[model samples]
Target: MEDRNMKNPLYLQTKMENIRRYSHDALFQFPKKERYLLCRQIEDCIERIIREVIRFQKRYYKKNTLQEIDIELEFLRGLIREAREESYISNGRLADWMGHVDEAGKILGGLLKFYQEKEAGRSGK
Candidate 1:
């Protein structure tokens, strides 16, 4: 059996948590009306990503979940960009948020590669 520590590195989880924290802080700066509009969507996306990340870590079949996380990350990225264009967030804030999303995307890419290789090896054997 894989060690618990090895199975759960918490890297993605930590990154997502940071995103959640930063975004929550930034959302408060948005207009009161936007609190339900764009802000709500962003919050939901982050929560979904965090949930999927946990699910990805636990499941033995990880590829699909990984793809889901990738998709969610992209959606979150788009939403953040939309927020900036709408003037809900500043350019500097957008850059900061994008930095966090990009970091998580890089980590997710590494995991996707590792799993794809492992899956291919199994098929070849």
Candidate 2:
């Protein structure tokens, strides 16, 4: 049986698209008073992380790509917590943002594990 739902570079693209959609909608509803500060920070953090992911992929830095994703995942997790603390986002929104983090982490973890196994197999030869 063929696994048609294979994960490739497009998976990362799809994930980034989701982030962009979420942040764009958030910024739209976010008050103008906090526009430049909170709203922009959220967008910037996500966008920069996405950029790093794309760069790593294009350069084929396999292990480094996973590491970058791990780092950015941590960053996003923290941002969610901080936003919650600052009361910029409601509990529902926090949960929603966390959902994305969880999904991304799972995908990144799978990628990292695959590479780690590959490395182990290579070294055992």
Candidate 3:
């Protein structure tokens, strides 16, 4: 039998970790005033994304969780944009951050597609 307790070595998790690290490094550049506001939100969103990736692997019904992750990713992207607009992060940082987010988003899109196809197959049966 397959090992249910085994960790999924997906690149999505790595991407999320990278985002967390990068965001932390970037957040330090933010002024003290924004630290507890926009910075906190971005940090929380990154943490949630990491958590949901693990939950998606463990749960039997994952569509909802995936959708949540998708929303969070979008929110994170928006937060990153806000940072850039406020000049908290530079264009280069924004590019790098967006690259990681885009990669993770693509991995998420694939999982969402797979689960959707699975549901369709079940319904068709």
Candidate 4:
């Protein structure tokens, strides 16, 4: 069994936890009118990414899961953009949160490369 602490270079567990925390903080202060809209959408986006990251870390695919994860990731990106446009995320706030997301994505890229290599290796290509 792998250690859940810090053996993994990806640091996805911590990233996902940050996502959850950030989203919770973001949503908690949102006005009631936004409860069903931006709040919900941001929550969903963060939650889905967390799920995909967890899945990626646990299961490297023989076939590509990028197509699958990309779908969710795209939605998350759209939600972030939408949040910015809605002013739900102020410029400073967006910068801070997206900066973390960027760092997380870099770590995630390493994991993605691992899966891609594993798939190629399996195919003997």
Which candidate leads the pack in lDDT? 1
Q: Per-residue alpha-carbon lDDT of model 4 for 1-106, expressed as tens digits?
A: 2333223534765776887798688767667898898788778777777676567556645124444555666676677777778777688877877777766665
Residue 108 CA error for candidate 3 (Å)? Answer: 0.3
For residue 76, model 4's alpha carbon misses the true position, in angstroms, by: 1.5
Candidate-wise lDDT, in order: 0.88, 0.72, 0.86, 0.66
Model 4 spans with C-alpha error above 4 angstroms: 1-10, 57-63
TM-scores, one per candidate: 0.91, 0.83, 0.88, 0.75
Better of 1 and 2 by TM-score: 1
Candidate 2 vs candidate 4: the lDDT winner is: 2
31-117, model 1: which lDDT tens digit per residue? 999999899999999999999998987898999999999999999999999999999888899999999899888888877877888
Q: How far is candidate 1 from the true structure (C-alpha RMSD, Å)?
A: 4.0
**lDDT tens readout by residue for model 3, 12-89:** 787799889988999999999999999999999999999999888788998999899999999999999999999999
* Top candidate, metric TM-score: 1
